[model samples]
Target: MDAILTPAGLLQRSAPATDAPRRRPTREEAEAAVRTLIAWAGDDPTREGLLDTPKRVVKAYGELFRGYDEDPHAVLDRVFEEVSGYDDLVLVRDIPFQSHCEHHMVPFVGKAHVAYYPAEGVVGLSKLARVVDIYARRLQTQETMTAQIVAAIDEALKPRGIAVMIEAEHMCMSMRGVQKAGVSTLTTQFTGVFRDDPTEQVRFMTLVRSK
Candidate 1:
């Protein structure tokens, strides 16, 4: 697992990100791939300051992409049925998340707003936030992540209605591409009552923006 060290830096990926992984690159292989990227980016990975860079980068990537190992449905599995007769919109706002863009591999950081009307029971409020984190920790588009959150909750909780909105700033745009700073992209998804009634959508938005 030792060689002259690759200049890839962090350019190479370990394996295809999917539920079923038949094979994955070894740690040395991953580091070498990073070294390959460093060389591609015009940096000498063997330099004194850069010697440990590949290892650090690989470690950081593991945390950033831990979502791949998580089960979204499991987060909502423990629901609380005792609502005392409560049946209305349950909103969890401003759940901050960081995700990588599938196309560029740069980050898109933002906050997510989620809400749902209870059909049978309710999940722990924090469980909603956990769901957001599960999807956000993966490479994704804001649009797909938004729908995925709604779908996960819908299937696990069987809620009467669901609403999810995400607003993010893609680093690919700010750090590269057009280089327009502070530009935010927003995405949303709705189902059941929220999808059927415009007023409910308004209500969800109002609560999210309030304070």
Candidate 2:
């Protein structure tokens, strides 16, 4: 198990360990698994219309979970220090993303807002969105994903402060269980000055809410 950071900046109980190495399955094996699942659902996977469905699903899964192969640190590696002593909040808002729930493997579509106060240098604006996409492409929970975005920027940029907020609608919640549609979940994480300064947090929220 690995410890997960909470939105309040406290370390809580560890999450299930995901670092264990295992043999990678072949494409044929993956497609076979999909066929087995189809059969379990009482569908004929070999029917003419369904014969290619397994291959299609396996291909889709490869794209859906590609983030697991990406390194977020690499995305933020190039920083430009040519700022003329500009020290203020740099924010990118409403970065749309789609991710799968780690629990049920269903989708949770959302938007992320990221902000940071530069200490000396700053990353490219698009890099912020790239970072969000990298993490969002993985199996995730909203809370863990929020914390990860904040942590990555804080570590890679060493900024004066960092704040991230995510608004999402989870299919696992809406399409199943209680089945409450049109509901959204919001999660936020702040680090450094953003965590200690009340006004900075407010300012970030205000900017995020601005039209």
Runs with alpha carbons beyond 4 Å of true place in candidate 1: 1-21
Q: What is the lDDT of residue 155 in candidate 1?
A: 78
**RMSD value for candidate 1:** 8.8
* lDDT score for residue 174 of model 1: 100
lDDT (0 to 1) per candidate: 0.87, 0.90
Best by TM-score: 2
Q: Among all windows of ten consecutive residues in candidate 1, which has the lowest summed lDDT? A: 1-10
Candidate 2 residue-wise lDDT, 123-192, digit = tens: 9999999989988899888888887888778767889899999999999989999998889999998888
**Model 2 TM-score on a 0 to 1 scale:** 0.92
State residue 141's C-alpha deviation in candidate 1, in Å: 0.8
Per-residue lDDT value at 136 in model 2: 89
